[model samples]
Target: MKALIPTGDPAEPVVLADVPEPVPRANEALVKVEAFSVNRGETFKLEAPAPGDRPGKDIAGLVVQPAADGTGPAGIARVVGHPMAGGWAELAAVPADALAVLPDTVSALQGAALPLAGLTALRLLRTAGPVLGRRVLVTGASGGVGHFVTELAAAAGAEVTAVTRDAARGARLTELGAAAIVHDPADARGPYDIVLESTGGETLPVALARLARRGTLVWFGQASRTPATLDFFDFFDGPESAVIRHFHYLDADTGLGDDLAALVRLTAEGRLHPEIGRVADWADTATVLTDLRDRRIRGKAVLTLS
Candidate 1:
């Protein structure tokens, strides 16, 4: 079998090399991967990869073998799966609970884009409770998860304000249902009922200050790679009841298979769109990863088996 493995070389971080095939556990299904998406976090790991690290998370494929425990989709089924690692390979052993059967309406590329980013958006909105008629702000609105957050939040009846500096992305964000577009968080109108913030550093505090009374600010990522410094007194200036919550997509009690099914259903219904900014053959994984790390790619990047 061929898989992408970390080379521990900064100049060439990942390389396609022959590797032993994965043996699935009783609760895991063996998938023949057709496509997979690259994420920002994976790019960071490639920068300082450890020996024997196989990096991949989002995969879409055919289930060649079902779990021995009789869970997950039965027979040969088209599915989207969230594996912890080693998805960038000819095959992957995915937990049955993390696999979702995809409708014929959705393509492998779209399925590959849904797991991590889509789940993050879905779970975050769930955590925020009902958003109907509320004021919602999505920072880093042009990225994969941010794009999903903007669309899903708007669809749920929230008046969504998306923050992104790129003119091109701003235009697309508007098309995706963002009610307003701001170049920076500082420029956005405040008293937002809910805020989904990923860009860290200065943007975090600015977004925090805009919260409405009892508003919740969900912090998910620090794309800027800069630490945020918040003054304890600043909390006094905002709504006294406002809350700041840290979010991790996997922490939710909802099963991954169920959440992924929701996302896939929405895509099939044309209610959600996965913004695929780049697509390439798996042979070019290294180059595609470089572009992702440099921020040259705007949304999810998918690589096909070719």
Candidate 2:
């Protein structure tokens, strides 16, 4: 099998190389690589791709090698429920219990887009505290996770306010259900029920100040490539709190299936529309990695195998 390794060296660490195939263990499944996508949100921003270090985390593949142990039979791994080494090559070994059954309507390329970004969006939607008819805001609305958050919020009947940096992309964000699209959230008067933040830095403080009293701020990944900092006074500015809360997806202890369930239902029903930026083959994993790090991607960048 071939894999793109993320080394400490950014200039040359991400090149591809052929490696031995992995075998499934008890409670594990060897996924015949079908599709995988890039996550420039966290891991890549921290370190460059090194040898043997696969950077892509989201995957969509078939179960070829099931575990010999009964702990897993059809061998499936989940998107973010567990820490599977991640999907970035021709084959990936994951715990059988982790994967969810893919419906016929969703393609492998689409499945790969679901796991991480989808789950993160789910968690944010839940953290948003319900949107039956409330107005909500989603920052970074055109990117992968942002798109999910935007669509999920809209389908739930909330008037979604999407914040985007580019004008051309802002036009399309309206198609995703954004009531208003702009380069910055500061331009909008909020008092929103919830705001999901993918863009970090000074903007986080600004988002909080715009929140309604008792409003919640559900933030996850930071894509601004700036160190995250916040003023406690700013968070407590509202009659209750300008920013009532915060959340983290990188923490391994949080359980988010309820959020994922919400996403699965919407996806299964076709209420949610997934926007794929570009689809690449498994052999092109290195290119996907480079494109994401360089921020050249238009939407979700996926690598397909099957």
lDDT winner? 1
Write candidate 2's Cα lDDT for 112-215 as tens digits: 77777887777667666779899887887778887887777887789888888787777777887788886887886787877777778877778777777777
lDDT of 1 by residue, 138-241 (tens): 99998899899999988889999999978899999999999999999999997899999999999999999999999999999999999999998888877779
Per-model TM values vs. the true structure:
0.98, 0.86
> For each predicted model, how many residue pairs clash, with residues at least 3 apart or on different chains?
0, 11
Off by over 4 Å in 1: none
**Model 1 TM:** 0.98
Model 2: how far is 95 from its true place, Å?
A: 1.3
